[model samples]
Target: MMLETGKIRENHKAALPYYYRMVIEVPEHFQALPGQFLQIQIESKTTDPLLRRPFSIAGLSRNRVTVFYQVKGKGTILLSRLQAGDSISLLGPLGKPYPAVPGPKIILAGGLGAAGLLFLAKNLSLGSQNKKSVVLLGCKTKEDLFLLDNFQDLGIPTYCATEDGSFGFKGLATSLLTQKIKKIPGKGTLYACGPNPMLAMAGKIAAKHGWSAYFSMETMMACGIGLCRGCAVATINGYRLACVDGPVFPAEEIIWGKLPPHPPLSPKGRGLK
Candidate 1:
């Protein structure tokens, strides 16, 4: 991992409510791939929130990187205050990236979890040729969705699900996946990143259908590197650090029952309802 200073090219509210997007212009030496993340040092002069916050790379170009986040706590509140021309510390391109697989592909995203898959989708679209790929997104309502156009613009078929029936499908994204997967003529790969319950369900569906799958696990971290050992994920092989070993792992390897339950959503907001 490299420690680099990048200037805020743009930091503003996204088209969706309760969400924000930030773009950074980094030096030539900095590089990253989809599924890797950055540890951003929040500029709080007092150090009240001492640790850096982890954000998945949403989009990346020659020298520009984008991250999407929700303001849910003190650290994020500070992050939202940053503006254009601000300089920020970034330690990243950390963690393993999703593996490239051939054949038909299916991407499943839940709420803000969509942030981590955009880059992967972009790469997939470039060499898609005869391959069939699709994206299924889930949220509480239509208003809770964002980046649907970004995916659609790539010509990848995109579908959405909302709990309240405000959008595409009237149920959960996993339900949408179930319906779509059955229609595929042959076996394909599954890639998912979302709330634990959503991911667990996706894993189950993939296993039932005998499709290969990978998942990006979200967890708490004090240090982005493996030194702290704070972001352990329970797996069939025992606990693995989400930072070094993966934020992404083979779906069959994870022990879903051993994972900690996602915290209850607060009145303010939390990922997908």
Candidate 2:
């Protein structure tokens, strides 16, 4: 795909403090799937905060793209300053996108991990009657919640959990998932992305219940195009690359927190069925 540039059409903070959404115009060639991400270069070289960052597409339209992110680091803090009409270079519609499908859905997100799962919920639930999506969003407090109404507006049920008991559930989102795993049918699938701990927990839960799930990993990448091999991960058979293999995988296939002892041919290479 040709590298197309975009201008930020709107940047606004939602209910979440320091978490914002930047909507930019996507060129005609930029076709994005849910759970796909874009690499954004923030123009603040002198300042410690204006480095580059990657954000998942939170929502999409025919002409524009929106990314939602938290102010966790310097790069994001600068990108938050983008406003309507500000131009930015985007290197995506990159990476693989979450498979858009129908079934009882659960968007499992932890903190910033919500970015990848939110768009999937929005895309799949579009035009469904009483959307079956059950989005479990985890944060430290109510101030950390993102796009609460966006899901509700789509008729998707959403649940919020904060460590401080400032919202819906007072425990971890995985704990909430633990309780509901048995309720889903055979076709039910869990879509998760977030911190390592959250992903680990989800992996364990899915394995125990025999439920199908997809995971979007948070890996460090030097080159987004699968060349540098900096983001190699251990698989059940051996080490696998995250970029070319997957940023998304079946819950049972990944090795979890560490690389597998040996090299496992990536399910990504052959499209594991």
Top TM-score hit: 1
What is the C-alpha local distance difference test score of candidate 2?
A: 0.72
**Tens digit of per-residue lDDT, candidate 1, span 7-97:** 9999888854558899999998788888999999998366767899999998889899999988778788788888899899999989999
Segments in model 2 whose C-alpha atoms lie over 4 Å from true places: 44-51, 127-130, 259-273
Q: Among these predicted structures, which one has the highest lDDT?
A: 1
Question: What's the true lDDT of residue 91 in model 1?
Answer: 91
Query: What is the lDDT of every predicted structure here?
Result: 0.88, 0.72
RMSD (Å) of each candidate, 1 decimal: 2.5, 8.1
Return model 2's CA RMSD, one decimal: 8.1
Task: Please provide, for model 2 over 101-217, each residue's C-alpha lDDT reduced to its tens digit, 9 standing for 90 to 100.
Answer: 556768888877787676787777765723566788887677767666676676677888888899888998888888776666564678888777778888888778766788887
Score candidate 1 by lDDT: 0.88
**Cα error, candidate 1, residue 265 (Å):** 4.3
Tell me how far the alpha carbon of residue 160 in candidate 1 is from the true structure, in angstroms, after superposition.
Answer: 0.5
